[model samples]
Target: MFIDVLKNIVITIVTVLIFISAVEIMVPSNKMKKYVNFVLGLILISVILSPIVKFLSNGDKEIVNSIKSYEEIFTDNQNKFKSDNVSTLKNNGKEDTKKELFIRNFNKNCEDLLKNKFKEMTFKSELECDVDFNNITFNIKKLRIGIADSKVNKIKKVRINKEKTDNKEENEEYSEVVNYISNQLDIPKEKIEIYKLEE
Candidate 1:
């Protein structure tokens, strides 16, 4: 009980400091250094308390475990992002055109993969795919679609969408989506496969 009170007190103090910093920045003060100090102080307080905030917010052990599982999904998705097929596809100057083609092709492949290739998908309640869109060499960044919410359906399903960029981050957002689904649904990482468009 004491620990909780202390944490709340610290959080409240940090929140007040942020508000004060914003107010200080808006005020017509000749002391620019003081304003900067206030802003920096606010940032420092937030940096220190962010983890605490997350801990406080995730009061449930199950939720926290689910988040860990979600992280694993993200890790696996990243491994798939680095696959040869993904690397082979490049996004050049004509990104938009390639994106359209990739999406069309990806959707077709997903339908086929679910129906003919990986029949297990239709049996599951979730489907997701991620695409990278800004690969200037192939003109693709990332694309992803997935079932974001499923607590009501009593079914766990995800549809991932992503766009790959020229930078390594192109596939990162897609990984985030997968991680999010895994975390939200409390699904184990082993149960989810990184959905990719076959080259």
Candidate 2:
């Protein structure tokens, strides 16, 4: 590129110089010669500088194209980075929500189990409890039981620990139910509450 531009510049300079010399020799009047020389000088200057102007114009396009390509690459990279970050955030949010939901459902299932057991033993009751989960495993947090009375006094259950003898079967009552729950849930009696309902 430099060589071609240099050659063009040299050729233009030589041609303009020769034309100026010829015009200076051919012109007659001194005043006319001065005017003609001034014009020729201007023309010579334009011709000599034409190669540089052409080079600059051509170089401007190449420079602009390279800068444009670089800008496009940078924009593409920025967009990809942003997209990846958003995807990670969404996945993390989903995981946390899923974990919370799992714990909630497990607690509900525990409450239902207790309700079923109470029903089977003919004990009309309502219960609530909090469940503990660590690393996706279930444990107990707290428990409460409610018993309603029908125009009578309400009796609360007492927690007991005893092994049944093979010779005798036991009748189901408040104490038995409390013991059953305490054993089944592997929770202390302090964590289990019994509410007595008034008629």
Candidate 3:
């Protein structure tokens, strides 16, 4: 609607200017020529301004609609962005939980496998172990050297032999056990430690 009014105004101004130019060429008196030119200038300005005034009518509605559309688009995009962030956070939390569970299960399995292997050994000894987070420290916290035979009597003889234990035999036995553990578990020898149980 506004464009049609603007185009008509431009055509009118052009037509009027051409007519004035043709009249000015034919006018005889100089004073009449000046007055005619002044009237034509005023007529041209009014023609141009008339369309501008019409363009301002009902313009507030269009402006309001434009602003509202932009705001709606912005709000939609903001909501979408928030939802994407929430999903990513949820996925990250789930991934972390999965990794923690896997690590915990792996540690438990290692403990069970090592315990069963210890029980299968020839000596009747009891040992408890702990492995580090990086699997670099395998420590034997408790090691009971000998097991008592089952009997009905409650009373027992306590023998304290300070000098009778053969160091060579004990070292060989300890070395054999350590080598077997290291080989079976495929863990480094430096990471393993043996300790006697506290009475």
Highest TM-score: which candidate?
A: 3
How big is the positional error of residue 111 in model 1, measured in Å on the Cα after superposition?
Answer: 2.6
Summing lDDT over every window of 10 consecutive residues in candidate 2, give the lowest-scoring window: 164-173
Among residues 3 or more apart in sequence or in different chains, the pairs in candidate 3 whose N, CA or C atoms overlap within 3 Å are: none
Residue 109 accuracy (lDDT) in model 1: 54
The TM-score that candidate 2 achieves is 0.39
Which prediction has more favorable lDDT, 2 or 3? 2
Error of 3 at 60 (Å): 1.9
Candidate 1 TM-score versus the reference: 0.19
Best by lDDT: 2
Question: Which tens-of-lDDT digit does each residue in 116-163 have in candidate 2?
Answer: 766632223333433233454544555555444344445445535433
Q: Please, what are the lDDT tens digits per residue for candidate 1 over residues 88-110?
A: 55434355566557667755654
TM-score for each candidate, following the candidate numbering: 0.19, 0.39, 0.42
Candidate 3 structure lDDT: 0.60
Off by over 4 Å in 2: 1-55, 120-199
Q: Each candidate: how many clashes?
A: 52, 0, 0
Which of candidates 1 and 2 is the stronger one according to TM-score? 2
